[model samples]
Target: MKDLLIRSATEADFNAMWDIFHTHVAEGETYAFEPGISREEGYDYWFAPRASTFVAVQTLAPHDRRGRERVLGMCKLQPNQVGRGAHVANASYMVSPYAQGVGIGHMLGEHSIGEARRLGYLAMQFNYVVSTNEVAIHLWKRLGFAIVGTLPKAYRHRRLGYVDAYVMYRLLDDPARWPLPEPAPEEDD
Candidate 1:
């Protein structure tokens, strides 16, 4: 995964972003967005005028005609709500199927958290994460998000019929709200 860089996404990256986003949506396992989402719809959702969209690019350069690096994944960070709830950030991520399981998601999660804090969000909340998505559940927990709540039979999973959904949350700026876990004898890092 060397030379993989995370940066602000531009309109030039939309096609690659759409490819990854479409693949996930069409799978109907994780995100709740409808299948066969149109490009215009995808653009409006993922690249809304004010959304903070980002991409992970492999910089070794099998460049597109525009001479941009290949996009391996994408994510968007934005206010979880408007007005009263705007202090909480919300984000969604999509990694190319070819790049899954190689720590790209983790990289994106870490960067998103930092970016959220930098953008002055007091906390981050994932409103609806399908309970069946174990890889994402594990990564979000490791990244310091807590399952703050769960809605029973919340998602109509494409293959699994009905499944629960979780509301994962983490405080970005309030140290008083952060839990103080005891140190482990052995740490992954």
Candidate 2:
């Protein structure tokens, strides 16, 4: 892995964070966010008071004269739901397009899992993963998530039309004691 540092996002990181988020939103393929979303709306969604936002910064080598670290990615972690469902965590990750395929997503995913566990969440769930996003689907599955359910034609892909979305989840605590219900067996004809 590169000399990457993952830390809680601060006020100084908002512009960089927004840049990465806006870029991805403009792509209109991964997240459900609308394109041309305003900075205020982006702030509210990514840096909400209740959510824990993080930034991944790549440190410059000591010999580099520029001596500046760059933000390569960002992620937000929050409750999947409110009240009785608060125990399960949810997260969204975005990597700078220039930094894609460099393992930053894996770092962010692993960091979020630990952070979620530290926050007392018993599990982590991604509610609307676009089924056509094979890279993410593979990554999440490699990171321990499972396709617990699929919402058919849930995502309106900008180019692929309506595509199925997956509900990916992983237990942070004891799996046998996880509170969610198991699927009923299919009846034989």
Candidate 3:
């Protein structure tokens, strides 16, 4: 219906971003974050200015009645750790229910991958994805993320009791196209 732009997030976006995050977290299927967590806490986590956050904003097209853009989704790319692990980017994405059934998530995810590579990340990893979120899981799999690890009964879902969680990883580079060295053989052998 309109043109969508993915742009860097700012403090002005905190309220809009929290609305989406809180709604999704309250659903108890996608993320491990506590739903009752306060707005301040959500702000601290999602609006960490030091990290990379992006918003999918819908702008009016020519002959449109709306004058301003509306935020449809938000995405954040954070470091998995401080030093050595910083080369890997970890991301979380949320799309407003009003924006569902559209391609907002896919657009945000694709934009995030390009941003990660441009930011010099060697790889991207989703540390804890609930197995029950089939939509997101399927999307990630289609996007080339491999299920590298799984934890049994890792998440304490409110109504579902316990559920499995996954660690998904995707190397940003194509190793086959740019080969690296094989490991040296052990002398004891």
Off by over 4 Å in 1: 62-67, 175-189
Q: What is the Å distance of residue 178 in model 2 from its true position?
A: 7.9
lDDT of 2: 0.91
Looking at model 1, the pairs that clash are none
**Cα lDDT tens digits for candidate 2, 57-168:** 9877756877567889999999999988899999999999989998999999999999999998999999999999899999999999999999999998888899999999
Over 1-189, each residue of candidate 3 has an lDDT whose tens digit, in order, gives 358889998788778888888998898877788889999999888777558889998875645776466789999998877886787899988998899878898898899999998987778999999888888898899888999999999998878989999999999887565334467788984
Better candidate by lDDT, 1 or 3: 1
Q: Which stretches of candidate 3 lie over 4 Å from their true place?
A: 60-67, 175-189
Pairs of colliding residues, candidate 2: none
lDDT of 1 at 44: 96
- Tell me the alpha-carbon RMSD of every candidate: 9.9, 7.1, 4.6
lDDT of each candidate versus the true structure: 0.91, 0.91, 0.86
lDDT of 2 at 145: 100
TM-score of each: 0.88, 0.88, 0.86
Better of 1 and 3 by TM-score: 1
After superposition, the stretches of candidate 2 with alpha carbons farther than 4 Å from their true spots are: 61-67, 175-189
